[model samples]
Target: MSHYWDNLSARTNGQHTSEEFESAAYRLVVEQVIYYADRHSRATYWLIEGFERDFREALAPLGITLDVNRQLRYVYAKPQYAKAGTASVAQTLLALVLRALYDEGARLGQFTDDGEVVCDLVELEEKYRLMTGRELPGKGEFSELMRTMKRWGIAKKSDESLVQRGDSDQTLPYAVIIRPAIADILGEMALLRLAQWKELDHMPRIEDTESEDDHEVTE
Candidate 1:
């Protein structure tokens, strides 16, 4: 028990007891990425910064490792043993599209002062066409994927209704706040591989020979 833990316990009336806090920390790493800008990330970040040894020790037995990027100001989990081909073709394509849009938004100074990049469905679709020479996912699939991305802290939609409707015209540029977590999700090596794939005009297919090492935690 550290002084920090003591203060946290006092603030939360022991509701965030050590066991409870550790469980919450582990859940955060497993379920959602921890970003400095996300309000919910504060507690997990505090736990990692203040009780890193305890946190790591607790997760070590589960074969999950914490990847803390100080420069990026975020944390995510990686399995010690690689899982095979976790990303479906649609998911991989969507991630690449988002990464491309993130880069474009940054280059155009479309990011907010707080460093969130905002992109709309229309822009995403156009970019997808340009990059892949293929149509974007159907509306239902696209909306579902967006919801999944939102859950994983990659992006946040401005209007839930617009997402549900899945009509780009009706939504008329529904903006998604792209968080810094995208960089961590895609990473440098993944992006390089995607670039190579694109140069070779390799269309993403379900049967594409993607190794576990080439895939990231899209699900």
Candidate 2:
């Protein structure tokens, strides 16, 4: 066995093997999070609990925090300060909107067995308009936004495997399943920033924050 394995065994008291640790770590790292309710990720989610200490230790040096929610049955890595210079302002807005939707669903007890909140395109459009005073993005941008949501573990389409199905290259994926990870990803801080969005003279740059949008938008 490798050095990490040997040490991990001793540290975890042999409750979980090195391979289990590796699997759990890989999923947490690759997916940015893991939830027990997600059928494909259920096993790894429990494994993460066993190796939580090691995960925190490994992530601490990089200024990332590993949070495990026992009630929610999920684990995710959160950076102290992150500059995600990839997703656009519109995309970020959509993500925040989805997070708000999840909150609403939670309050209303509208959740799936896996704790996901479901909504369709029309409802999303209405919420977007009500929240941001804007309609959904253009078709091309909508497609990209959906891709961003899934890539960042925010939301997923019902037909997730085929997000853009029609010949128009537009995602009419009316039905979407908002992941529970959004709560951790956006948190209350990010949502507060989003609620104050209209007051800002400048828009959120592609380089916004992770747990919070610390990058102050300026003209």
Which candidate leads in lDDT?
2
Q: Which ranges of candidate 2 are over 4 A from the true structure?
A: 10-19, 81-86, 160-174, 199-219
Clashes of 1: 0
Compute each candidate's TM-score over C-alphas. Answer: 0.68, 0.73
lDDT of each: 0.66, 0.75
Task: Point out the worst 10-residue segment of candidate 2 by lDDT.
Answer: 210-219
Per-candidate RMSD vs. true structure? 6.0, 6.7
Alpha-carbon shift of residue 184 in model 2 (angstroms): 1.6
Candidate 1: residue pairs that collide:
none
What are the per-residue Cα lDDT tens digits for candidate 2 across 1-219?
Answer: 256756886776777777777667666767887878778888788777766887787667677788888876788877777765445568767888898999999999998877789987768888988887667898788878888788788787786532444566655546878988898777687678666766552565334534544344211
**Per-residue lDDT of 188 in model 2:** 83
Query: Deviation in angstroms for 157 in model 2?
Result: 1.1
Give me the candidate number with maximum TM-score. 2
List ranges where model 1 is wrong by over 4 Å: 1-16, 69-73, 107-109, 159-173, 196-219
